[model samples]
Target: MWIDKLKDVSFDGRMMHNMSLASLSYLNIGGVAKVVCYPLHVEDLSNILNFCFCFNVPVLVLGNASNTLLSDAGWSGVVISLKHFLTKITVENDSIEILGDIRLEKLLAIASKNNIAGFEFLTAIPGVVMASINGNAGAEKCSISDLLMEYKYMDIQGCSHSVSKKDILCSYRKGPLQTFGIIYSACLKGEMSQKDLIQKSVKEKWEYRRNRQPISERSLGCVFKNATDYCAGQLIEHAGLKKKSVGDVAVSDIHANFFVNNGRGKSIDFLNLIEEVRYCVQNKFGVFLELEIKKVGD
Candidate 1:
């Protein structure tokens, strides 16, 4: 009956049932999503939301899944993915318009080829613009808010609105309209940097991120947020938590704050690893580490 409600709505993308969450996230963990819908356009997303709202079905927005963890028990709701619906990137004047589904890596490549500046720092991150915007992801001391000028998002009622930079309240890794709804697209101001200069900056930053992180491992990047001037990785490493492990999950040897899934790592193991590291860091340094990654599902 729930699936019947969506049957009448016209869709421009794929719809499936019982899709594995493990195959979707970067860590290759998690259980199944009840219903997964990949919408092809803004209208399609609005339709999906409207239908879900009418039927009182819960809606979950997902993207690249680089910075999130789904529960092993799985989600009992409709999971909407903008990956196919909003993946376009366009240039207007000195600003770039990125659809919510656009991957940051693809955006970097597009910007680099066009000799655009101001996004070199984003190369260090690994998620789509939508998820990054949700958490206001950043690197090299620069955040997604730094380049954001205007953005568009649809509310729970399936109504879309465009927002300006000043209207957004940003702090650390938060966007003003973060929890309002699903973001559609964003327009960011860019500067004109030399092609060679952009290339060099990107290369340098990319290399630095690769060197300092466990980039090759199956992990969700940084596991915790910095509590103060000291990085979370440094705090965990200082607390001697690098040797700690829970089943196949372990604090990354490369970056102490990164928890890696060493082949078939379960969500329970990851949770235990977090508990151990959190307790150790707090006891040793008298500082509480905040989680940076989002954990979803029931």
Candidate 2:
């Protein structure tokens, strides 16, 4: 068994058996993860990857679970969550070096305390700093990639590479992680500015998100990628998918693009809702709607 193989490896980290993935995901829905490993540090991450890759153990690299959907049948392989121990953050005058798992909320506080500007736009974003960079998460006409200085990540083979901004090819809601595995750390630049200005910007951004999105609901972020000049929310709304439900999962009435788990939501319901929404949108507009969230498991 794969569990027996993991036991043979010398790992200075943590592991759980048949863990409920719903607890980790924002949607509060998912099935069991057969074997879940949490690395202690970067070296521990490499060790875990090496063991999994060498032993032919199926590896599912997960971070904050903000953009992931796990099937109800459960994951048959090892689920590796890198967030539990990747916790290092350094704030310098010119840059801030942060681990991939550090939350954006904490980074916002760090920027505020250090009088760092240009990070206020990130105050309202969900998940860790790397999540934003991985998906090129954006708002207010700016993206996390715009503020990046450089970043370091690990490939599936556990090899580390430091990439500069020029090397990183980021598009709207897309990032270099398409080819990469796990991000280790990033150095983001911030400028000195008036403290009150920073506070105002953060407040405004927070308010914008609160008003526009279903911030209080259980969702896996945006359901689909934007089409051309129109956002996914607009397309969904135009297709009359708002408030549409399948089982316990329903599209948010406040935002058409956000599919929220009302109560006891299941992955099957989520997938069904996606199909319904996609079918409607495509049939009406003749444009295929692509999913933004990553689906994992059986």
For candidate 2, the 10 contiguous residues with the lowest summed lDDT are 123-132
> Best by TM-score, which number?
1
RMSD of each: 1.5, 1.7
Clashes of 2: 0
Candidate 1, residues 142-219: lDDT per residue as tens digits? 888888888889987788988888797778877657564898788877788788999999999889978988888888
Question: What tens-digit string does per-residue lDDT give for candidate 2 at 1-298?
Answer: 6578778776788989989988778788889988888888888888777887777878876667777787898888878776677487888884789874787888888888888898887765677777678878776677888889899988877778899978888888887776747777899898998788888889988888899888888888888987567788888899888999999999999989899999899999999999999899889887788998889886
- Which number leads on lDDT? 1
**Pairing residues by index, what is the TM-score of model 2?**
0.94
TM-score of each: 0.95, 0.94
What's the lDDT for candidate 2? 0.82
